[model samples]
Target: MTAETDLIKLYSQRILALAADMPLAERLEAPMASVKKRAPLCGSTVTVDLDVEDGRISRFGQDVKACALGQASAALMGQNILGRTQAEVEAARDALKAMLKDGGPPPGAPFAGYDVLEPARDYKNRHASIMLALEATSQAMAEAQQADCA
Candidate 1:
């Protein structure tokens, strides 16, 4: 197979593997905060839910229906965000956006885990899918924090 084809296959397989490992129940639970993002060009949508207490995430979930990249991104977000604090999640979100937009460096230790998505940087269209969950999570956390203060 050509190198390009192989890369596509590899990324696709990785996404599938991540998706397969996600538990449905974890993605369906009610969230203290929720946000939705859609990639209109691809008709990909991701809805992320979060429950936070004392600045730490107490619960996390999402309902996603989209391409492999979107699904995999959601799954990865679910796996990694379970115990992280609001500040940590925000850092990761910023890092993820920078990475996708300019291939900029990651946002330090709290967001280093986002490196798993580095392989996706070269895949342009996949960028939107990958960012969907991150954006939703960040927005949800922000709104949740605001509500807590009100």
Candidate 2:
């Protein structure tokens, strides 16, 4: 397909809708862990705050300032974040990375929402932005896990 067609597919209606519907899209007060990631090429950014209990996220929040692709990714993560264990969140992030970088299948159920982003694989410049949400979530989960151990 042509670049225009690919672009159209990348920014489909579903992606736009998801971009606007991120849950818990705010910053938590006194969060146990927080992470912010920026896409150097586009300057898109996403911040995540988390509280984990018993290895699962008990609370989650975020501020996403990015292009539609990034927002859609954040929305997918936000929609499924609560109660996810750190391992689960990290696995989702890894799966997303593989999908984008290695042309692998979309993340599994729950994170299956990420399937819509498959068209993004051809746009390397957008990869980091697309990854920011899950990247921050995984990092925040790690920090929360460490804090819990302390």
Which candidate comes out best when scored by lDDT?
2
What lDDT would candidate 1 get against the real structure?
A: 0.73
Off by over 4 Å in 1: 1-12, 23-30, 105-116
Question: Model 2: C-alpha RMSD to truth?
Answer: 0.9
lDDT tens digits, residues 88-146, model 2? 88889999999999999888977877999999998999999999998898889888888
Tens digits of per-residue lDDT for model 1 on 50-135?
87788877777778887766777677677777777777777777777788788987556644445556777777777887788878
Worst 10 residues of 1 by lDDT: 22-31
What TM-scores do the predictions have? 0.80, 0.96
The collision pairs in model 2 are none
lDDT by candidate, in order shown:
0.73, 0.91
lDDT, residue 13, model 2 = 99
